[model samples]
Every structure is written in C-alpha cells, then in structure tokens.
Target: MASKGLATKRRQESGRRKGKEDGDKTRGGGGDEMKAGGGSSWAWKTKTENAKKVEALREIEQLEQKINNLDREKGVHLYNKRSDFRKLFCTLEEQELKLNSDRKTEKAKLRQQLNKMRGSVTKFQRELHNVKPTPEFVEKLKEIMETIESVVSEFKEQQKQIYEELLREEQTLNQEVTALEKRLESWASAPPITIETKSVKPKTVSSARNVIADLPPEVAAFERFLLQTGGHRGGWDEYDHGTFLRIRNKFKGKSAFLDEAATSIPGRNITDVRQHENWYQEYLTLMEKKKDGIQKWKIVKEAQKDECLTQAAVDEDEKKEEEEQKTRARARRLEEERREQADRLNAWKVQKELMKAKEEEKQIEIEMRRAKEYEKERLRQLEVRNQVQEYLQRKQEEDAIQRLEVESKKAVQEEEKKTMSREERVRFLERDQRRLEERLAKGKAKEEEQRKKSKRLERLKGQVEVQVERDPSRLYRLTEGWKERKKDTTSASNGPVLHMPHRAVPSWRAGL
Candidate 1:
C-alpha cells in the first residue's frame, strides 16, 4: 500500500513539473496562443493581431504624415513670419532712411531759413542804421497813409452808393410783391357761391355752426352744461369718469355704489357723481339722436359736396389762369428789371475796369522804376562788398604766412628746449663744448704762430742791421723782402673766415 502511495505521489509530482515545463515551453514558443487546444484560436488571434498591427501601422503612418504636414506647415509659417519680419525690417529701414533724409532736409531748410532770417535782419539793421528819423520822414509816412485812407474811403463811398441803389430796387420789388400778394389774397377771399341741390332738401344741416344754431333748447342747454362742467380744473374728467364707471361696474348689485364710485374717482362728491351719471345717460340719448341727424346730414352733404367740388374746381381753374397771367407779368417785369440792372452793372464794371487798368499801369511803372533803382543800389553794394572781400582775403593770406613763420620758429624752439632727454642733452652739451675747445685751440695756435712770426721778424731785423754794417745794398734787399713777406702774412691773416657764434646755455640745460 505504501509503495503504491509513493508511486502515486511521485507520478503526481512529475506531472506537476511536466505541466510547469509545458507552460514555460508554451510561453517561450509564443504566449497564450500556444496553449493546448488553441490552434483555431491562435490562427484567429494571429489574423486579428496582424489586422491590428496593420491598423496600428496605418495609424502610425497617418500620425507621421500629420507630423510631417505639421512640420511643413510650421516651416511655411516660419518662412512667412521671416518674410514678414524681413519686410517689416525693410520697411523700418526704409522709414529710417526716409526719416533721416527728411530730418536732413528739415535741417537744411532750417539752416536756409536761419540764413534768410540773418540776411533779412542784417538788411533791416543796415536800413535802420541808414535811416534818419526826421520830421520830414514822419510827415511823408503820414501823407502816404492819408492818401491810402482817402482812396479806401472813396471806394467805400462808391460801394455805399451802390448799396443805396440796391436798397431802392429791393424796396420797389418788395412793394410790387406786396401788391401782387394783396391781389392774390383779394381773389382768394372772394365769397364762394352756395349751390343748392334740388334733389335733396336745401334745409339740411351743413356746418357745425348751422347745426348748433338749429339745435333744440334742451340740446343747447346740455351742450352749455357739458362745456361748463367738463374741464379738468374742477370737473369730472375722462379719467375720473372712467374710474367711476369701473368702480360702479365692480359694485353693481352691491349697496352704496355711488359712494364707492365717488371714493374711487380720486376727487369727486356723491352729488357730483350722481349728476355726472345723469348727464352721461342724457348724453347717450342725445348722441343717438345726433347720430341719426348726422347720418341724414352726411347724406345731404355728400350729394352737395360733389356739385360744390365741381364748382370749386371750375373756380380754381379760373384763379389758376389769373395767377398764371399775374406770374407771367411779374416775370416780365422782373426780366426787364434784371436786364436794366445787368446794363447798369456792365457799365459800372467797364468803368471800374478802365480805372483799375489805369491804376495798375501806374503801379507797374512805379514798381518797375523802383526795381531798377533797387537793382542799381544792390549792384553797387555787391561790388563794394566784393572789393572789401578781396582786400580782406589778401590781408588774411599775409597774416597766415606771418603766423606760419612764427609758429614754425616756436615749434623749433619748443623741440630744442623741451624735447631732449637727459642723455641727448648731455651729448649735445659735450658736442658744443668740443666745438668751443676746438675753436679756442685754433685761435691759440694762430696767436702762437703770430707771436713766432713777430720773433722771427725781430731776428731778421737784427740780422739785416748786421748785414747793413757789412753791405748796405744786401741789407736793403733783405729788409724789402722781409717787408713783402710781412705784407703777405698780414693780407693772409685779414682774409674772410666764417666763425660760429657761441650760444648761451639755458639755466635748465646747465643744471641737466
């Protein structure tokens, strides 16, 4: 029994291990699809997975295409932005250039304006300087002003005369218009003829005034009462009446309706309310009678209205013809007046034009003469100015030459005095000392030679004296030769020789 149990246990353990291995194999092969009894499922899953993979790949491609499209759009957008920025920058640059040019132009204009103003100021100053403020000048100015004022006053007087004439013509036109308007009013005010229709009764009511006149005493009394009491000041107005009616209707079958109505009406007593109710009832009855009468009147009036309109039309046509004739006459008169005014204006214009032509000719001649004189003065001034400029230019050139010479001398002195280093200064001083020593030595040697020549001459003179004792002729020849030699030596010593001047060393250089 134990062996059977052990065998069963071992078999169970082996089966479990095998199952685990099978699971690992299946997982290693290809996941859940490789499990037992999964062939159809595996194929279906593979197909589905392939379809899903294809769909995923398609989605990824779509996404990639979208990304590429986005990138392309971004590139285009960036390019557009860059172009816009470039355009804007170019625009800004152009604006800046334009502004710079404008500013330069403005500066030039300002400079020109300043120059013009300066010239004007100078001219004015010169004029002021040349002017003499004399009584004669003042009197001339006053006379000129008076003459201008007189001319202006004369023009104003002529204008006043023209205005007076226009006012007279306007008054005449106004009077004629008033007469025409009065004639029209007279024609319009003529009484209209009454045409009685034989078909209807001639006694039918026509106007409200006739209706009132034909009303009974009771209706006249009612109308007078209504007029007296129906005002808003101390009466039951339409609003009060409406309120009273509304309250009365609301309280219709209840007690004390008049009191309620009076209360509801804002400002009315029971007595007034009762009277208003009575008047309203009587008004309703009167309105029915009035409506019947108005209907009868309307029928008669309508029949008469047609005939009256026909007569009125005929009368209007006649009036229109008369008005047309009047208007034509007025137009003819206006035309004639306008023609006369035009003739007068034409004559005035011609006269004014002739006067203006004369004035303008005189002014032009004066201006031309003044311009000629002014041009002569300007030429004279310009010539004088040119002469002055030439003289100033010549003086300036001479002064510049003198200044250049002075500046060159100063530059040389400054360089010599201030530009030397200690070593250079020592070198220059040593060189100068050497040249001075050389000059002194040459002078000393010349002095020694002159002294030696003097000694030799003395010796020769002594020898000549000794020889004179021996032979007078030989001594004389020797003395003559010595004299000639002395003359030659003196001449040679007096010959022109250049000497360098000694310079005094500055205190600073001496210290250095």
Candidate 2:
C-alpha cells in the first residue's frame, strides 16, 4: 500500500509538472503568435469567435450591398440633376451672351453720342476763344469804373464832412457841459457864509461915505490903476507911499501941478489946489495912520487874484485836454474812414479776382476734361499694348517650355540608347539600397544622440526643480539680482541715483 501511494504521488507530481509545462508552452506560443501577427493573430480563435466574425462579415457584406444600391440610386439621381443643370446653364449662357451683345450695342451708341457732344463743345470753345473785347470797349469800361469811383469818393467826402461837423458840435457841447460841471463843483465846494449876530459890526452908510471921501485923490487913483492892471494890493503899499511922496513933492508949493494932475487923472474934478490943500493934507495924514489896514487889504486882494488865476489856469488846461481829445477823436474817425475805403478797394479787388478765378476755373475745368479724355484714350492704348505684350510673353514662355520638353526628350532618347544591362541595373539598385541602409543607420545614430541629449536635459531640469524646491526664495533672489544689475547699468549711464519717495500707507491699511 505504501509503494502504491508513492507511485500514485509520483504520477500526480509528474502530471502537475506536465500541466505547468503545457501552460508555459501555451503562454509562449500565444506571445509568439501575437508578435508574428502584431497582436492581431486569429489562428487561435475559438469556434464561437470564428462564427461571430463570419456573422459580422456577412452583415458587412449586406451593408455593402445596400450601400452599392444607394450609390447606384445617387448616381442616377445625380446624372438627372446634372442634365437639368446643364440645360439651365446652357440657357443662362445664351441669355448672357445676348445681354452682352445688347450692352455692347448700347455702349457703342452712347460713345458716338458722347463724341458728337464733345465735338460741339470743342467748336463752341474755339469760337469763344477767338472772340475778345475791343480796346475801345475796355477803355469805356475803365472810364465807367473811374466815374463810379469818383462818385463814391464824393459821397464818402460829404459823409466825412458831416461827421466832422457833428464831432465839432459834440466837442462844443462837451466843453459847455465841462464848464457847467466845474461851476457846479465850485459851488458845491464853497463854504456857506453864515452871518452871526455876535460877529456883525454895525456902521452907518454916511460913515462909509466919509471914509471913502477922506481918501487922498492920488491914493484913489493908484487903487483904480491897480484894478485896471489886474494887480493885487499886497505890494501896492510901497507904490502908494512913493506916489504920495511924489505928488506932495510935485504939488506942495505949486497950484499949477494940482490943476494938471486933476485934468490928467480919469474921472477927477479938482477946481483949486489952494482950496483943497487942507483936506488933501488931512487925507494924507489919515492914510498914513491906516497903513496896517491897507496892508491887510492888500493881502486879501492878492489871495483873491491868486485864486482867480488858479481857476483860469485849471479851465485852460481842461480846455486844452478837451481839444486834444477832440483831435484824437477826429484822427480816429479819419483813420476808420480810410480803413473803410481801403477795405472797399480791397473788396473790389477781391471781387475782380474771384471773377477772374471763376473764369480761370472754367477754363481749367475744360482743359482737365480734355486731358482726362486724352488720358482715358492713352490708358486704353496702354491696355491694348499690355495685352499684346502679355500674349507675346505667354507665347514665348510656351515656346520655351516646348523647347525644354524637346531637349528633355532628346536627353531621354540618348539615355535609352546608352541603357545598362539587367545585371548592371541590378548592381546599381543594390548599391543604392546599400547607400540607403547606410543613411538609415546614420539617421538612427542621430536619433539616439537626440534621445540622449533630451534625457540629459530632462535630468538637468529635475536637478533645477530639486534645487528650486530646496530654496523656495531662489526665484526672488534671481529677480533681485537682475534688478540690481539693471539698476547698476542705469546708474552708470545716468550718473546719479534718483531716490523715490516712499509710498504712504493709508490709515485704514497701516496695520496690514
């Protein structure tokens, strides 16, 4: 029994080994088949799989048959559509040709009409060109223009004279107004005279008369002379005293001197010198006593005269200023009138120029139209010449191609005459195959080198990535270095460093 069990175990072990060997052989055979058929091998397919393939092939054949029927129908339909399209295309082509012919006829008729119109325009222009104004007519026109100018000048002169008269009246009225205003100002500025009872001094009219009557005749005459000469009495005291002494010396002992003085003096009547000697001597004594009063009176009179002279001078200056203002106004008006005349003349010249320009523009337009027509004809001729040249060039190119083709054919015939034998051709082909194999080997080597280079690049990229991972701020350091280099370069070129102001943080963002 033990022997039998051992035999059975050994047989089982052999069977297990055989089964493993068979599985390995089967796996190896599958691999070999896959390699030989590029993984599409069907030699080991099961019956069911073969059946499925046949069924699929049958379905494909049925689909192919249906597709062939659809293709035949589509072709028949397309043929019918093509026939209909060809008919339509032929009809359209016929219509197009008819339309083109009609258009050509109409274009020819319009061209002829345009030519006729152009000829008429040319004839009219020629006729007009020959007709010019006579010298007499031109002279008459000039005379008419001059007459019109003279009339306008006369009108302008009358207007200017009227304007001057008005200006003069205005100036006079202004002067009068100024004088009235000055008087008003003076009245307004004058102090009011108030009579107070405490300041009043009462005197009888007879006393005033007696004072006047008591004055020496010579003194009175000197006063009258001062009034007539517009002289103040400030310095008149010396004159009066001197005159009194002179009169006294001349008429003290002579009656004839008094008579002559009375007759020579204005509005004086002295009958006897001996009869008036006592009163005259009394008046001289009174005048001598009132010297202080006379001095005061002289000062008051001088002040009055000075005030009057100042007022007169002010009025004169005002008058002179007014005259100057009027003169300036007149000059401005004359200048304005002259400018208006000049503007009128300029306007007339501009009008004449505009008329001449319009005539010239018309002439230029005619010339331009003629030139355009000539240019159009020239362009048409150029187009015809260019077409001829292009046709000739195309013909020459075709001839050159034909010649090249003939040369190539002759070369091919000569090569055919010198053709190698089959063995030699086979040897040349083998040589070319060997050369191709060498080129393929070189290409494979180049590919290997490129792969090695790519692997090296990949290794370098991995090292750089590991380095960057080790130091995360390396990029920032690089950027800072680049910025420093740029700054150094800029500083070297610009010669100075510009310090920028530090940016201020907003109050809200200050903490951040």
Candidate 3:
C-alpha cells in the first residue's frame, strides 16, 4: 500500500509538470528552457520583450504582404493600399478611419483648387453670355486665366516641397528605427557573457547635470523652453515653424492667407496657424525692439569708451545688411499687396458680370413667358368662337330636319285625302266629329259628378265639425261613419279592400 501511494504521488506530479509544459508551449515558449532570474521572472520578461517583438514582426510581415499584393500600375499603390482593411482584429477600424480622413483631406485640397479656377472660368462664361464680345474683355479674361494658372502652379510647387520634406523626415526616422532594431537583434542573438571578478570598476552615476553638460547649450535652451511652455496652448515644433516660414514667404495677403498656410502644412489647421501668426508677429516686434536697444547701447558704449575698429566695421556692415533685408522684405510685401488687390478687382468684375447675366436671363424668361401666355389666350378665344359657330350650325340643321319631317307628314295626310272619294271623305269627317262630340259630353258629365261629390263631402265635413264643436264626445261617432263611407267609396273605385280599424285616412279624404 505504501508503494502504490508513492507511485500515485509521482504520477500526479508528472501530470502537473506535463500540463505546465503544455501551457508554456501553447504560449509560444517553443519548449525552450527558462532560467531562473534574481529580479523579474522569465515569464514577465518574455511577455514584455518577446511578445512585443513578435507583434511588431507580425505587423511588418503583414505590411510587406500588403505591399506585395498592391497593383503594379503607376500611382495605383497610393489608392489601393488605402482601400485595404485586412487588419480586422486589431486596427482595421482605425486604419479605415485614417484612410477615409486622408481621402477627405485630398479631396478638400483638390476641391479648393478647382473652385478657384472654376470661379474665374464661370465668370468669363457669364460675361460672354450676357455681353457682346470685345477685344478688351478677351484680353482681360486671358490675363485672369493666366493668373489662375500661375497661382495653381505656385500652390503645386509648395505641395511638392512639403511632400519632399515629409519623405525625407520619414526616411530619416526609418533609418534610425532600423539601426535600433539591428542593435537589439544583435544583442538578442549574442548576449554578453558576465565573468565573476574580485575587482570591479567603480560605477559612475550619471545625473541630470551630467546629461545637461553632454548636450549643447542650444539644445538645452530649447529643452528648457519646451518644458517652460509645455502648459501653453498651440505650441508648434521646429518642423512646423519651418513649414510656416516657407508658406509665409511664398504667399502673402489677408485673403485666404491663413487658409493657404493651414492647408499647406499637414496636421496644422487654421486655428494653429492663427495662433502661430500672432506669436510670430509679436516675436518679430520684440526682436526688432531688442536689436534697436542693443544698437543704442553699442553707440553709447562707443562714445563713452574706446572700441576696436575691426569690431566697429563689422557692426556697421551688419547694420547695413539688416537694412537691406528689411527693404527687400518691405518691397516683396508691397508687391504681394498689389497683386492681391488686382485679384480682388478681377473677382469683383467677374461677380458683377455673373449678376448681370443672371438678370438678363431672368428678364428674357419673363418676356418669353408673357408671349406664351398671350398665344395661349388667342388659341382659347379661337376655340370658343369655333364652338359657338358649331352650335349655331347644329341648331339650324335640327330646325331644318324638324320642318322637313312636318312637311312630309302633311304631304302623306293630303295624299290620303286625295285618294279618298268625295262622299267617303264627308262620311269620315262626320264620324270623327261625332266621336269628338261624344268624348266631350262624357268629360262634362264626369266633371259635374265629381264637383257634386266634392260638394257633398264638404257638407258632411262641415256638419261633423259643427257637431264636434257642440258635443266633444260625438267625434268617435262621426269618425266611424266616415270610415264606413270610405270603405264604400273604395269598393266602388277599386273592387274590394280589407280595411283595418286602425288604418290612417287616405290623403285625398283627409279633410272629411
């Protein structure tokens, strides 16, 4: 029994070790032995370093595969790569959102450029449509078109420079990343072997002061500035500042100045440009004031004490160079303003032409609509006159047809009378007269009888009314007599009727 229990315990231990090994393998351990460490455990180190490396390598492989799968046609890679969204489990949604954002930005840039050119073209077209062609107008339109082309070309050049700058930055970053990755791989492949020694070199602890000493004064100053201004809003980096300078140097004017600057710089918007502009203007003014103060101090120093001739000569040369630069800058600014004003005048002319064209079109439409309305009224009047004429003609035709029918009937009657002999005609007349006289006599007798009957009913009704007035109880008796008379009259006129005692009186005998 003791041996069996020991065997069972050993088996349980083996099973647990097997399970742990399986878990480790499943976790990408690849059955490698993990040595015990003094500080962080092997598992923790693997999770942090190895896991991160593996994830990065996988991402790189996926990117490479995507690149390989891209279309070989020129410029298709730019479009096709953005359409790919195979990173579903990790950053698919984020990549799609980024792609959409990039597409929208590109579209917006294209739309802005197109709108500028389109405005000029549409204005020219409107002017051409509304007003007669002239040499002066043609020349002006040509000039405007040329100006639009130049502006577009300048904008394109700025975009090209910005793209080149971005490419250089990306290449430099990639190079640094590759170098660091190579170093990490080399270290990982062959770790340094530590040997136990009795004597150890004294380790020097590097502090912030040592770090500051190692860096140049300019770098340290910049770092200090960065730290001091970290809490301030709308801070731009050196690259952004350089980009702003380039854009400012290229384009100048109040019209779309901020917009152009913002669009030219990737990731910088109008608000950032405005903030930078304010800060830069203040900085320039401050620097100018500072330089003036320095120059005044130098002059005072020279007057109060002896100064080197070489240094004085250098100072004069520097002051002359500064003045020249200021003059050049001023001249460039004035030129830009003149160009902008000309552009504004051209835009106003185009707008006025478009409005004039629209008004002419509206007036022409109104006139055409009035003409159509007049024509429609004339056609309606003609239709009404035709209908009236048709009605009169139809009435005449109907009257003629009726008259012909009466004449034909009369002819037939006359023909029949002519065919009859004289004596036969006389006998027929006597017979028709006798029949007519008999009908008249019967009608008179019936009318007289009806009148007498109505008179008798009236007498009866009056007697009943007089009795009812004299004795209120006599109403039922009179009503019963009236019912009997009604039954007799009904039997004489319409054979027989099954009379109900409660039946209402007929409307013709209601008075009785």
Q: After superposition, how far is residue 420 of candidate 1 from its true place, in Å?
A: 90
Tens digits of lDDT, candidate 2, 1-512: 12223233333343344445445545555565566766334444533445665675576568657756664543343333333344434444454456546546644653454445445444544544555588865565566556555654664576467457655544444433443453345345544322223245744233211332433354444433333322232222344434434665787756666666555444445643333454455555545645655566556656776666655555666566776998898677657755765797799999999999999999999999999999999999999999999999999999999999999988976675456345556877999999999999999999999999999999998888553347767756657667777664544667765886896653433543
- lDDT values for all models: 0.60, 0.56, 0.60
lDDT (10s digit) by residue, model 3, range 1-512: 12223233333343344444435444543323454323457667666766666675576567656644442221232222332222221243354446546546655675576567657656765665665488887788788778877876886687587557655544444433443453345345442322222254634433322343333344334333333333112256567777787777767635367888888888988988987787667555544664565466446545544434445455666566776998898677657755765797799999999999999999999999999999999999999999999999999999999999999988986776566556665877999999999999999999999999999999998888553347767755657667777664544657656774785554433543
TM-score of each: 0.21, 0.16, 0.21
Clashing pairs in 2: none
What does the lDDT come to for candidate 3?
Answer: 0.60
Q: What are the clashing pairs of model 1?
A: none
Error of 2 at 23 (Å): 98
- Give candidate 1's root-mean-square deviation (CA, Å): 45.7
Off by over 4 Å in 3: 1-321, 332-340, 347-355, 358-366, 369-377, 380-389, 396-512
Which candidate comes out best when scored by lDDT? 1
Model 1 per-residue lDDT tens digits across residues 75-174? 4433343233444344434544564465456446534544454454344435544566898766755665565556546645764674576555444444
